[model samples]
Target: MTTAPGSTRNETAAIGDGLRGNAEELLRELAGPAARLRDDQWVAIEALVVDKRRALVVQRTGWGKSAVYFIAAKLLRARGRGPTVIVSPLLALMRNQVAAARRAGVVAATINSGNVTEWDEIHRQVASGAVDVLLVSPERLNNPDFRDQVLPRLAADAGLVVIDEAHCVSDWGHDFRPDYRRIRTLIADLGTDVPVLATTATANDRVVTDVAGQIGTDTLVLRGSLDRESLHLSVVRFDDAVERTTWLSGHLDELPGSGIVYTLTVAGAHDLADVLTSHGHRVAAYTGQTDPAEREMLETALLDNEVKALIATSALGMGFDKPDLGFVVHVGAPSSPISYYQQVGRAGRATERAEVVLLPGPEDTRIWSYFASVAFPREHVVRSVLEALDYERPQSTAALEPLVELNRSRLDMVLKVLDVDGAVRRVRGGWLATGQPWTYDADRYERLDAARTAEQQAMLDYQQTTGCRMEFLRRQLDDPALIGAAPGSGACGRCDSCTGIHRDTTVDTEAVAATRARLDRPGFDLAARKQWPTGMAKLGISLSGKITEGAETGRVLGRLNSLGWGRRLRPVLDGPDAPVPDEVVQACIPVLREWDWTVRPTAVLALESPDHPVLTTSLAERLADIGRLRNLGTLYLRPDHPPVSAVNSAHRVAALYDSWEVPDLSRTDGPILLVDTLTDSGWTFTVAAWTLRRAGAPAVLPFALATPT
Candidate 1:
């Protein structure tokens, strides 16, 4: 074992070779016969097993962070210490970590949503001292049953605790997750003697400090170099989505072995994967929406090089191991450099060289702003959530949704923040108020939001910078070592700026035409809402159960978030005073041709749009003119009943309940096409169609220029 710098010879001798041999043996099992532990890895393992000290490791990806914990768990178990408890963030990560543990001869078991049937057996194994490591999702920490029953026991007896992706524990981290905040309490509950380790690949200096403070006092933070010698970085600027998609389709094959192609949105991932597959590239789309079983298959396919790429969102990132991944191409820039680095880090891990390219698009900023808009809800929203809580009874998030204006995801995030503040607690059934006084940390949230905005700006700057791209990224993370390096000295000499090797920045005119044709092929399925949202009667809407008569599955020109016609359709739908544009009206013809409806609409009906009446009416009139159907005019909005923004089905249904009146039900016969400027939450369409159906329309066909997904 390598002694600490300045350790006395006698002290080094006393530590002996047996401990070193064990660690070396564990490393051999993990990384092969020639493997040896880095000095930092050995130090971290010794700190956990021998010294029983808390350690925070902030190393780059594929730097053997998992090896430290796995080896430490093995050594601790040999000495009769209880199983190491790991707070992992994702199922992909847990699966990989568990596999890594087994290779090291450590019996690791996981308890996550994927295997509820196996959780009992896993818990029993941990209790029986048969497991060396226990991997769990951070959200599991807040599970009612787990928190109320199992957590205390685990906390008291755990030999060592490892918080993987520890950057998440800090709200300032790029990908701040609410459930990760629960780890602070978990660590505080552990016995004093139990050692703790927190590891992350993407933390900046600020994140490191915040995470270390949460993990406890005198915490040892080991941050290594962020530079990736294997990465050949470049930024390719594109004027539009078609050009970018076309470029990817044209040049994807030029990139070395199988890797990842990241898209900012799930739709973008699927769309790009489709476009590439059409161009004969072997690729698959992976996203948060992917089924667990399918995700496993995709991961395995990438691992075995069965496919060239997994066109994915950030869901496929962090803890997915592919040693020979040859490239990472971003269809659009991520919101921040830190996040970008985390995704790109997945590539060039085990290889000496890998290509990293960024195709920055005109819509990138819009996407970034859209995400930023959801950051930290207003004070009123937070207070309203707290007000809706009952001290005597627990309320599920869905139950709380109707009582508060915040959407489900935003509400769940706020609830978690409240949980960490001790204002509420998760118990059996759902969440209940603790009746504790809570102060809204307005300043902190503002600062974090501002920090995010700043990060976005930093990414933009990174794109525009002419200097070393890698150095710029390193500096953005506030890597002190890189910051202190002489100006221009840290230049990687591998990026486009340094090497002057541009990889066909311009897409061929033919390729661009093909891509434009693909994008212009505007149509997306708009499935009818099957059932009314729960608890609608309480909101004074009698709607419940399955819909007896409603719109058949419909068609839209495109999603409001789609990279194709959405870019054109958004302004027309969202802008003021103007009529629906000629291009959008013309685009609808093809959608109409391709739409396979059960029954053809014989008449047209427009839903009243107080904000965009001209746009909505013009679209309906134009479509009626082209389709040779009777224009039956719009549903009339009740006086003084302006449009209300209801983010969920229950609230949306209540807002529009009895608000629309068909002027003449006698005239509303046969299938009528329902037209609207846009559909969000799909509640507007559902309610409008239901109203029309009740007014004696045989069937309704819903059409909108845009539907927000």
Candidate 2:
């Protein structure tokens, strides 16, 4: 046996003997008395406890990966080691783990964004040796104060380091997160005697190799079959949104028990939740936009069967432990088979049978392309960000937005990447350049993009595959059990393809009509931007603070990504300039009529669209004629100043600062209706309204054919 550094062979053997003797009893304590460790589980526990080496376990979701870690942690603590530090990925996962630890008679505490007020106390408990396991989100690993002060102490004394959902540590994984890269530093800081465990259920061969290498060269890997016997997988295709909704509305209750209905976009979740509720199904929309507290409540609600399902996006994917979850329905397929496997794995973890259905939409590819656009920025963009940062003084994200072309979310992602690369450091106020020379890995990014495209193709293949659905997924994940299986012998005997038990695609005609009517109904409120983005003056604009005279709450016919009116308006907004469509005109009339405006507009004004001039002008004229309002001249784009192409808010506002030449509106009596083809960022309307209000118009009411959600 190999002895740990600075330990004699006698000591190592003594520790190994103690671990071997006590492991099963600890497992019984953690799991129920009747529950016993599987041979692989014991192998993993012995590796961490006796061998004192890093191990990577790639098993199915409900395969008692948590039991192995919790039992190992209890044994390690009993053997005079410090507490275990688990770098968990999600708040939901952390909550579940903490509860599981408590049930095992192990004391556990979590430090996350949702529990800021408890952090100091938790830190105190850890320092006082009162906490056995500390669960922290990967993002917390890079917090400046925690990194400089708390992490070093924890790393120095931690007995076992666990990375839950460890696939996230690999860029090749479906959900790659830059924050997870910080785990490399944490692992480096620990003593060689301290053991490490990285657990994930959805890693392919490439991801497993990548993550194993990152953990250590001597890491042990325990991989098993990726199939879930309880899952009965199938795909249901629909030609249009109305047909999909009709089928879902008619058949949602027939699916086993309360479960999740996944959507590709946030707007789709909200829209589908509304549709489901209207059909008398108890449901709520949960997305990245959901508040943390509300998310906790909704999770509990789902656990208690308070609602039929939480119409959710990928936000609710990992580490949610509802063992009895009966079904998982995807309204649109994710971009990769690995992602699909992870999502559908949430069902049937502790149940006998669960239904997994994918209602693949034609719009799924378009949504995937939209998400793919936010991949790593070009080399010049990274260089621009680095050059804009001050080496001594920190610059907040808002302060840098004016100097860079990336939006808030993309900018944050870039900054985090740079921070991980040691090119920048996030301090108390914001980010500071570390004077570290950094090379933009163009080849690496290109390779990643290529891999993503391949994964997308694999997802498409999964939807169309005729062979065993479970076997196809297992092969996609490079499951070892399928290596030598006879041809056509790996079928699960459960999926629709295997059993010839496809769901009836027939949706009721009346349900279809009602869904179509609901989808066609237009209009959503466009809340005005009340505060100007900071750092505007640095971009040569003097604006800051509240915009008292900005446009009032506006009306949108539909969102471009919305289920309703989005399909109809995309052509008008994205296609070449032409006469406005009559159906679009009819849609606008109802929006205007339903709008509970304090005072109706007496004049119509159109914002000049260089790309869609004919469409904008025709719509303005038609509305003016119909409303019997004066036709105010258009707000023309100033000469030599083309429309703003900047993506971030501050630069967008700066480009629009003096770009518009508003016609005289001093003679306009009532509120003047402002027209635009689409609204993104809401900056155009705010700036134009400021110009018009300064030019003596009464109140400005912004209207648009569509806006992005």
Candidate 3:
């Protein structure tokens, strides 16, 4: 057999023989001396260090994927090869990798969004060969400075390239990040002799194939059994949010040890965390909105077992490593079984008999639909974006928002995808069109959407399946070991279905009442939009700078996605137009009474809600009567102009620029209460309030039945 391109027969033999001993020593340093490298781990390391070939390792979460790379880095570095470059997905993962590298006597430094100040020093260390491993987020790959100035040298010099959570590289992956596509370009720039490795615990057959094809057709695939004996899986159905929270509050302490409680929404996390805290459990909320410093502190707290669990969103899913984590309870099921498997895999990694429970809610599909809406835009939207961009000039996202129908986050996602596809370039100022011909790839996107839908159905099936939970997940992932198992021997005999044992589904009456009361307590501040979105002038709107006359801080009865009022409000908002429900009207009374406004409103006004005219009108009239305030007539929209669509702020404001015909409020005194059925984007309230204030109202106090979360 011929040796790899960069190695002679003698060198290959030395790598095979002497390298194993060194790798074992490094593993002992990384893990304790009692630890040993599994055969598959050593196989991957040999493929990388000995054969200098690309490899993809699909192992379970606790299988020490990190060890294979760290030991390989050390072995390669010992041979005077350059430092390894790791494309990590999260800051939490980077921190763990860096600390683990130190245990192995490898110098590892990370440069990510959280450490902008340390980047220069880290770069200097990498350049001086003082760092054995450098971890960077996938987003850093496309950073203009990094892509233009730093990546070429790093790619040329990297001894080994590792993509952790490599399933994300594929659109077929549940968490398909566009930035991971940039890795293909980086790999293309690498020398033929440089070895590459990609690893993930959650890839299905499609995702694995897609990632392997992207990495290289000749890549070595080391796939192991996707089974964890320590996890006992179960699904508990809940009648409502109150029951779910009550059950958690009643049963949290009974869990094996500190672990995670996941919610689908940030608001839900905070809400559940609050409920659990009130029940005398120590918990903290973690989400994308969590500050980096606070996130680090919370992560440390969890690792130290100071907190019972972290109530979190998907932001906590990918890289959090807690070896003895006792449980993972999902308040709502994720959109797919692949995502569910990855999340539940977090528990029982190092401990025996960890609980993995799913409390499926009726509202889960609604939340899933909301997330699905943010996917790749329609072909028309993409073409519109391309047409609006300038070929030579860089335009910020803010500048382009008014010209497009997409929201900031969705537009940013589109731009990133476009940049990765060579249709646009993200430069110093912002984005520049490359004038490159680009196709919409409708077939690929349709397939992805279909796969997502199928996965969602599979998740629902998993929840309702009577067979072994682990076996079902394995089948979904197409685990290779299933083929070798004896017929009728696939069951682990640990899951609720297999063992015929399930957690208690009953919630105490008092606990349920308390949870209901807590959730029913409504009112979240609807912060006023203070600054005008940039580029309004381009839309023929003269608005700019601070809004001298705008709505004061507003009050929302509750979010449309809130645990308690959400259940009441979703139907009212989503259904056909009708008078405001008595329940919602009653809910608003407490909100107004509890609002800490500086001055009481003397008059009430309603914005024209074409979809819910009766509801908005009835709400305004009822509030005026209840509060004993003047009933200012409705603000009618121009006949030709429709209600502003829920696009970005700039477009919304422009649509509402001259659309509302404010009623005469010159005779009104104190604050004018502006009532609308729903508040999304908050531009309607701002523009309407600005119109009211300009029309001689002293102040505008915006109140809404609900706001979309």
For model 3, the superposed segments whose C-alpha errors exceed 4 Å read 1-11, 484-488
lDDT, candidate 1, at 576? 74
Q: Give the TM-score of candidate 2.
A: 0.97
The models' CA-based lDDT, in order, is: 0.86, 0.91, 0.90
lDDT of 3 by residue, 589-694 (tens): 9899988899999999888887889999999999999999999879899888865665888888988888877777668878989999888889889998888777
Instruction: Give me the displacement of residue 558 in model 1, in angstroms.
Output: 1.0
- lDDT, candidate 1, at 485: 76
Ranking by lDDT: 2, 3, 1
Angstrom error of the Cα, residue 426, model 2: value is 1.5
Candidate 3: deviation at residue 129, Å?
1.7
For residue 228, what is the lDDT in candidate 1? 87
Q: Which of 2 and 3 is the better model by lDDT? A: 2
- Superposed by TM-score, candidate 2 places the C-alpha of residue 457 at a distance from the truth, in angstroms, of 0.7
TM-score ranking, best first: 3, 2, 1
As a whole number from 0 to 100, the lDDT of residue 666 in candidate 1 is: 79
